[model samples]
Target: MIRAQLELRIPNMTAYETITAAKKSAIPDDAAMLRAAVELTKDISAARAAIYWPDCFLSAALGYGALAGAVLLRETWLAVVCALVAALALYRALLFIHELTHIHRNALPGFRFAWNVAVGIPMLTPSFMYENVHTLHHARTRYGTAEDPEYLPLALMKPWSLPVFVAVAALAPVALLIRSAVLVPLGAVIPPLRRVVWERFSALSINPGFRRRPPEGEFGRMVFWQELGASTWAITLIASTQFIGWRPLLIALAVFSLTAVLNQLRTLVAHLWENDGEAMTVTAQYLDSVNVPPPGWLAPLWAPVGLRYHALHHLLPSLPYHALGEAHRRLSAHLGAGSTYAGAHYGGMMPLLAKIARSTMGRR
Candidate 1:
């Protein structure tokens, strides 16, 4: 029978049953809880999400302005200060890409275009790369499996791979520059090259095994223009370096590299990363993900723009980024001490990193 075949295909029915029972007991009605949270936050305006645009623009301006001031002043101490500030600001601004994915197109008209022009193109990480790709990671059947483009089992990898994973992000700026400046143009002219580029270079994914399918319809047109914009920006930056001098370019690279590194660090603790390509249950995904709650002063610095409630986001993917905090507060108050949600809270980054390190070493 088809039911028997499905049971055979599922790796561990015992484990699945255990997880299902746990989830049911912990949150008696997950759907109702989510619906209530949605209703509770319904009166909150979607326009609050649009307000992120000005903040992101201002942050980017401050970052670049400080870097320029540092270059003009020609002081090592000032340059160091400027670089740190730039890194923080740029990292925060770049995170709007995540927000852009969730915000309805009609709710924030022209905001996506503004963001692409200001942050996405200049950084060579256009929004198109992430738009369609991230949604897959949130898919119920895809998450924590090989099909999830955004996930990898870091805790199950070799102990040495952890440091390498985080350190490699420092080189992302160079890789992104090459991707935009060299790959995009070449791919445009050659059909075969375009297919290769689409599969390999198009997505903002971390999984090595994931390959992107070619964009189609309106998505294809959007991808084309976004790529063109990034290519033009990359070419301009390269050409301008010759006349404007390389110092500013070097500062830009440094800022980008630092931002990438900071993001990688945040990502490292985003989850326990122990799924090992298994098709996880919803509770398993929530348990594997992390949430760093209050009293952690540095949580916002690392997990900015509502990422601090990452596990909760997975549970309620439709909730806008601006409403996550309030949702978490409501969910916590409603769910109380016995809820499975408590298991997702890591308290702070240091503890999370330590737990991951222990898990990595223990697997060794």
Candidate 2:
């Protein structure tokens, strides 16, 4: 009913190129479009520190500022307003974690540290949560398979799973607190628990069956420091309630919970989520992912940090967040609307979300 009302409101919206479970076999990749995507975007692939630093820092700064106002204002309507602002700003800041997984570590020196200090550890989502995990989603053989940490066949699951998938994220702040403040700290004392936490709870992933291998090499060393920072922060946050009282902590948790929910909603439509755990070709994976591109508006707000061009991101995983818009424009104009590259471009977030929701209900 909400979707029907939304569709009626957008009477002039572009008709979407919907892909459902039944439509999988018919949607093949255009090899020429693939080559064009790689070739055309080469010049823009390098991450610009100029764009990365300010965006992440400002978003984090604004988020925390608003969160403070919310807590200070108490239960008033203005506090509610501030809380919402905090959620949105922090959601934008938090999504930089996705960019962290893709961009070269050396490109933005101190960015990883700054982001962790400002946004990541405080939010209990250090860059390490995504660093090793998200790359597998782009692996040629792992994309859309059980091995893909981020892949989930939501369209193939029962209709109930859709709401469950999204609703569960509302508890993410609480879950992260427990994971960091309790499980991780305990895991440090118990070797078996540490391995379990590493295998099961370490990643920011959607696939229930996906278990991450132990972190190795310099990556492992990086993980240790990040984990220590996150755990320490989490412990401090929990312990603060005794002195500062529950009001501030509860309000902050509520704000973070809202942020998590927004992200989960974005994740819901990030892809069609219809691969059925099979290995897919690169183009097939790209087609499965969704892009909520421009002229519709509001995508950048919901799918911030260049995530609005998610399908294109899968095609050229190294293209930095700031460059995605230009890359998308070049490819869209070059390939035209009828090409496979255009297959993933949708009108807007609601329609794309409605499309995915409908898919789970056994409709096209």
Candidate 3:
């Protein structure tokens, strides 16, 4: 989904370790590794704390606003307006999933289950799986190519292929759902087909390299419990909501779907535009993925959902969404002008899509 270029000059190990150790303490060596680990943990914790409140408020407001709009609004035009407002709310909820899962529980009390039910299950994804995948993304984000499961493989793009490339790409999510719900349950009995299916998934955003083996051991049990517990709650909510009438339920589901689409479009705008040729092969964080001149009035609304300063988020995913603007400012100051880490919103979809198509097609 990303077409950004990333270049990381690997540091010399011994010297890098020494420097990292130096930053933590005056210790010449030995306990340097522990200190570095502790320092990283501390930094991540601090970042998590910075954005916790706004994230919670964003979630509550989105949920309540959707409910309120659904209850108060009638008429066809009002339903359209309700859908727009609900879509924005749901987008924030999805982003909240992305944010809360990254947050360490010790950094924020009660974030564990709150993130699971409120964010994960509503999005129809398992939080435990996301925790593993997301954390590893931070670990090896810059390690692109087919090796890094978090990125789409180079050969995966068939833009000029038959059945039309764009249509195939757009239909990918439906294909994924079918595979997950159907083929995945068949297990080892379908080894040959499974292998082919696995290859297809391997080409997508999440690399199968770091995929969690569900039936393995202790961690497997924990993942199961988390997934099961959250899913039970989500199912209960959905089933109980029948009493609230199908109208509201359908409206909410529609809102969630539209919002997810909007979020995806926003993601493409921020990250998928081709830069230099080499840049297309890199991780999203390095591709100069940024916003393009978003409206002033929209900033407040977008800021809460982690859209206003997306470039910074790409660079530093561990930073809380709320702290993104500040982080962008500071990083921008450090890097000076022409830094891709800072960005504003660009207007409209057609122009950007045209630019991306031309770039991808190798046209001037």
Candidate 4:
């Protein structure tokens, strides 16, 4: 029955076809049952692939490239240039990583961890920690409050101040990086910072799976290891640079930072819309996310990561990123007018920014 309920929302080739497909495929000679199983399996597989590899590899490679480029380059400006390129790589990478967390692991053991960590660790963002919070975001009654990490309360915003609001959304990734690298490190050291640390940590532990799921446990351990590894990498870079002189390190850092900033833009594009302040729930995944149907030139970045067809991704998180486009087309063909968005991109920013700014001026 639970499986049957989900089929209604799952993306398929077409609504009529989805229904027909379900009917034709239903289990137990009883078409409904067979269809339900097929749908369920597809859903699970999609989710798994989305979170794990071949799906996630492109993004991870991008992040690694940026950080590595920063470390290896000899010229300062050129190093920064490479770092920017690396950042561009990661910008695309995070998309896959974001999708990967939505997957249910049991579906395809093949693509699971390969994509998750491959894409996740390089971003210096732990897959495990992301999974915990992200899963909660899918829960009943989650958005608009402290629980919604991505939440931005309309109540807090000044009415009509579109520019400020837009600015907030645009610069959010910067805020995230600063908070992660600076605030988190400081929070760890300062006794007074315990509250913030606990709040973030509590979010991880508060979830039911945090205590019950072994995958969750593994994630926790991985977070510790990744953090240690990232720190060690930073330190090693520093030491090596001192020995060889700072040129290489400086170049690498520039490339890495550039990539990080580009990632911020793409990340913001994923969710910066204005909506009623409803709780972000599992069922609401579609609402909180956006799809990026990339142009041919951008496909190299988005196709591998599975972000180009993100709406389908929200519907099926475990499917490998590579499979997302095909799945999305199939589902989109099935759903037709039922879909809400085709998703937007950062390139649409100039007008969006201007509109928001105008909205704010009128309010003031």
Candidate 3: worst-modelled 10 consecutive residues by lDDT? 1-10
Flag regions of model 3 displaced more than 4 Å: 1-45, 48-51, 64-73, 153-219, 233-249, 273-285, 291-304, 339-352
Candidate 1 local lDDT, 1-364, one digit each (tens)? 4334433423233222223323221322244444555666666536564457677899889877876765676778988898888888888889989888877888777889989988898899999988999999988779878999999888777788889988999999988888889888998788898888889878888998999988899989998899999998888888998898988887789888989988998998888787767676676677678888887899999998889989887877766777788787877787664455565777788888887888778767
Mark the 10 consecutive residues where model 4 has the least summed lDDT. 21-30
Ranking by TM-score: 2, 1, 3, 4
Instruction: State the C-alpha lDDT per candidate.
Output: 0.78, 0.84, 0.47, 0.47
User: Candidate 4 residues 249-352, lDDT tens each?
Assistant: 45544444454544444443444333345443332344345555544455444233655454455455455565666655554454343432222222343433
Task: Choose the strongest candidate by lDDT.
Answer: 2
Q: Residue 238 CA error for candidate 4 (Å)?
A: 3.4
Q: Which candidate is the best by TM-score?
A: 2
TM-score, per-candidate, Cα-based: 0.89, 0.92, 0.62, 0.60
Task: Tell me which of candidates 3 and 4 scores higher on TM-score.
Answer: 3
Model 3 C-alpha lDDT versus the unseen true structure: 0.47
**What C-alpha lDDT does candidate 1 achieve relative to the native structure?**
0.78
